[model samples]
Target: MLEKRFKLSANNTTVKTEILAGLTTFMTMAYIIALNPNILTNYGAGGAELWNGVFLATCLSSAVAMFVMAFLANKPFCLAPGMGLNSFMAIVIGQLVATTGMGYVQSFQSMLCIILIEGVVFLILSLLNVREKIVDAIPLGIRLGISPAIGLMLLNIGFGSNVYIADSNFNQFFVMKDFFGALTASHARDVMTDAYPVMVLSAITMFVGLFVIVVLASKGVKGAVIIGMLAASVLYWVCDAVFLGSNPFASLATASFVPAFGDMASTTLFKFNFAGLAQMGWFTAVTLVITFCIIDMFDTIGTLVGTASRAGMVDREGNMPNMKEALLSDSVGTIVGSCTGTSTVTTFIESASGVEAGGRTGLTALTCGIAFLLCIFLAPIAAIIPAAATSAALIYVGVLMMTGLKKVNFDDLSVCVPVTIMLIGMPISGSIGHGIGLAMISYTIIKVFTGKAKEVSGLTYVISVLFLIKFFLAV
Candidate 1:
């Protein structure tokens, strides 16, 4: 039954088939159970119980969000805790605390409050049609560049599952630390001495999975990526259990449809540090909320628009009708995530993978959503998913996301400069808004200086001026 269901394609899929496809989408995204917890813990906010709560909250919020996006919004996209925003909440907020002497929990509460406010703000803008207008205000070149940059950012984080960070003079990165960590740590030593046997195993899983997909796809295989990866992961586990006498990593393996009650009931939600927000002042809260709202809006819209374009989900009007639902559902997810004791819940660009794998309609999202709900009980088994294994998927998706670059007009300096700035700024600046803001400011300067200012939108000019003032004058 599973195989038959998995063998359906988005282009030819019925509602039933799309639902089945969504299940595979859920499996592919299941890593978030661990990933979200790990990221949020950096803020002094998580433990096993916290992780459980986050998993539950994430599941519930996402399920609700997806339902809206799927059944309510009627769009074929999936929503989850966004990748980049969590990092900001985890790391950037930590910095804010250090500089401000705010308690971590208090700061966390403040941030959550900020997120809630951002959601409300987004809801208002969306309703007023202001959000869409702002999005339209962005330059075509800079707008075109955001998607691939997001993909790159996602690919970078995805690589971390395999590579550990180490201190370095040159803004330390993955390479050197991974090299040394392999020799020093016992587990690293064990994996390395064994020539990354698990990684090798995961590689095989990925290879075999890709092969199956390619072959099945040729034979009209639907859900090829999902079927291939699952088969490979299972094979990887079986080999480990048989040869090693146990699968140490099996605990973290992604599972489909196993709901976790314990995680949900105990999850920390609505536990706001009103006192903390007070200390930060209404100004800070408002600033943070504005920042978050702007970032989340661009981030979510970019993901949805890019994903929809790829999946051919765009309408004849060049607009996806249910985007309003996607935005609303995402805001609700953020509120739920805060109440549940985790990072902000936003749409994931990674859902594009499921769409590419024959996911269309709400069925695919529903399947993925159901799979996420099931993951709460499977927490203990998450270790089974190797970083290297997931990295392959990330890299694959990155390759796909990069395809958006074809739309950029490199020949036009007006377009090329801003696009180039965005590409460089996102990863280096470590903030999507920074990358985009710089691009906008630079684009505005270049166009105005070049006498092509008339082509830019009035709002774009106003926003670009604000970016300059906020970044230079205010900061």
Candidate 2:
């Protein structure tokens, strides 16, 4: 049935096998149920209520994409709010808000509008088959560097969430001696468990999960990610009972079926007030939008390519099978995410976790999508996974993403300089789009000034010009 839908050749694997693989893939990525809401709520959309809405939207969008990819396109991939988009939402959009004096809500709405426009543009480009032109226009090295750069940026954000970097107004830096000192000291024992226990248990969950995957992989066990996640959940439960003196598992075991859409109903959607956008001016908006779209497109492409490559899902052409369809679905996913109340829809590098676990087809994406769909009923259970838990996973994912740096063409100044700019600028500027724009501008400058002018294209020059105007305003 799936083979027919995705136009797969006969001799495809049995449906039963595909189902198991897909569900395993889904379980590995289940962490997103908790992670997305946590990140979005930083903008003041909070409570179980707001998170419930986010959970529903993520599940629905991802499911639609996965089903299309699986039964319709035969590609194994997942889609959600991508790492780069999240950074833009948290940092770049925040900057926009701060500079414009618009409240966070208004800024979120604006960013969403921009993302929606970007999706429409992407859809047009894809349908026109001009995507390959845009992609091929960029140097292969730059295109290749995008995935790893995104990985690094994600790692940077994960670190920022887990570990604080304090600029103490002095050259020296130090830890607080303990991360939980403030919590424990302020509450004077109001914490459910002592800070030490919480940290130790969370660490235990993390390390044990890592160990399970590593050991299982060594033994050729399929579904290592699922095993690892289950192991971590069990450990978390045990530690909760032993140290926290309460079994959180029981409370979390209840089914979750509530959709959080009502909470967001009062919020604006699809209503793009051109007034503020007009104030920014068409040139500026176009420039910013172009920069955002290019970076996001490349960043998402790299993620899809890299994870697919790792999964052996790439064809002889180095393209993921059904690549066009995946991109189409992802483009639409971004638009829906924006309309539903979030940042740009992007491919998560963490999906690599699922790939690493032996998910080889769209079934993986389908499984994840279904799990997300079911998450609407399991919201409370999803919430119990804890920030520290997914924080560890994201940091681990970030570390994995940085491994791509080894594959970079370090000897080529053209590649090395731009890639390094992305590596540093993403963390420093706190925005992947900013880092990419700077790198493109720098790349153009190098190529142009070095008399290698023929290597640069008119579009490259156009983007560079636009980037300069945007970056100056942004700075």
Candidate 3:
């Protein structure tokens, strides 16, 4: 039945391979299960109950979306409430509270209303195939650049922001900025204080696990990525226990075993606050919705195109098959998120890790979705997987995606300039959409200035202009 449903043999995969790939994808992205609630609830400022609500919502909504991806599109991509989008929603909620003196919970509910409307709008556009057409409007050069740009974004996440540590003084540190950037061990120790040892452990684990994955993959190991992550997790646990004298599983001590359905029901379940939105004014509501929509649309498109390219899933023109179905899955997930209480759900770039691990069919996504559902009861166990281990997978996959850059025609300045800008913009801005936007604007400006205006499509010009407004117009 699994073979028939997923056509596993047709995709040159076995059930074992797909299952391994699925678990690989889930482990790499599982951080969002905890991190999303923390960010959206402002580190528990919105209340611990609200945090628990978002936690269950994250798992439930992500599982729903991934299941849709499996059955509707037969794609192996995982979906979750996006990282940057959640931060943006928190910012929007803060602005709402400041503007109208509304309570934080009221402001958050109003934001959920906006997300619901955005999902409905996307669903309508997707049904009309308008979103697919928008994706088609992007120039082929820009499309090709998207994969490499996303690769850079992954690298940024792996080395820069993947492991965050707050010291006794509440001083923050990252792998690249503090550990690698520090001039010396003493300097890092001086600056980071007590957090330096943990930082060192993380760096060692990341590089060593990355090496394990690389070596295993070179030898044609079937489950190299997952194996490497497990190896890394064990190593981190040992190091924490032996060196740091801390229990790696200590978090499990106070962890709640059951899903907090009651908290979810009282806090975010069906909690749309349209009246609060109206108080914020129609224009503000519309603009906020548009902002979320635009960011989410390109982010999804970029991840799909980029990861698909790495997986050899795209046509020569750089478009994926069944894009409409894949997009519909995302829109539906966003709707589920708003209803259950969270931010916009989109395709995670971490899906590339699964692709590299040999996932090729819906079964892989099915496995991932099932894992997310289990996280509701087993979140503590999932949390034990070290952040460094996932960073290893991300860094490895990022390196794999950069191999797509070989397809780019660097001799053409139109391709080189835009691609160049995108390569930098993605890592710097931490947004695949923003990188694509900068590349589009640069590509348009270069063509027009070079007396090749006729080559730029009308839709391309419109998209470029919209990005301009987004960057400069400031709402």
Off by over 4 Å in 2: 3-55, 71-73, 83-112, 146-194, 250-256, 260-295, 312-321, 386-407, 423-439
Give the C-alpha miss distance for residue 239 in model 2, angstroms.
1.2
How well is each residue in 329-420 modelled by candidate 3, as lDDT tens digits? Answer: 89999999999999999999999999999999888888999999999999999989989999999999999889889898999999899999
Clash counts for all predictions = 25, 6, 0
lDDT of 1 at 422: 82
* Candidate 1 lDDT tens digits, 1-475: 4334323343466655576567655655666766776776662264455555555776677777777676666556788887767787787557767877875555665677767776677767777777667767776666667767766765655454333332222222342245433444465544355444444455555556556656665787766666666666777678778865665564345444355456445446676667667777777777767666667776676677667766666654336666666677787777777766666677776676677666766667766776676556555554355444444455555656778788788999888988888887776665666777888888888988998879878999987876776677542
Q: How far off is residue 36 in model 2, in Å?
A: 4.2
> Which 10-residue span in candidate 1 carries the lowest summed lDDT?
167-176
Q: Who wins the lDDT comparison?
A: 3
- Candidates 2 and 3 compared: the better one by lDDT is 3
Answer with 1 or 2, whichever has the higher lDDT: 1
Q: So what's the TM-score on candidate 1?
A: 0.80
Relative to the true structure, how large is the alpha-carbon lDDT of every model? 0.65, 0.63, 0.92
Least accurate stretch of 10 residues (summed lDDT) in model 2? 168-177
Cα miss at 412, model 3 (Å)? 0.8
Model 2, residue 224: what's the lDDT? Answer: 59
lDDT of 2: 0.63
- For residue 199, give model 3's deviation from the true position in Å: 1.3
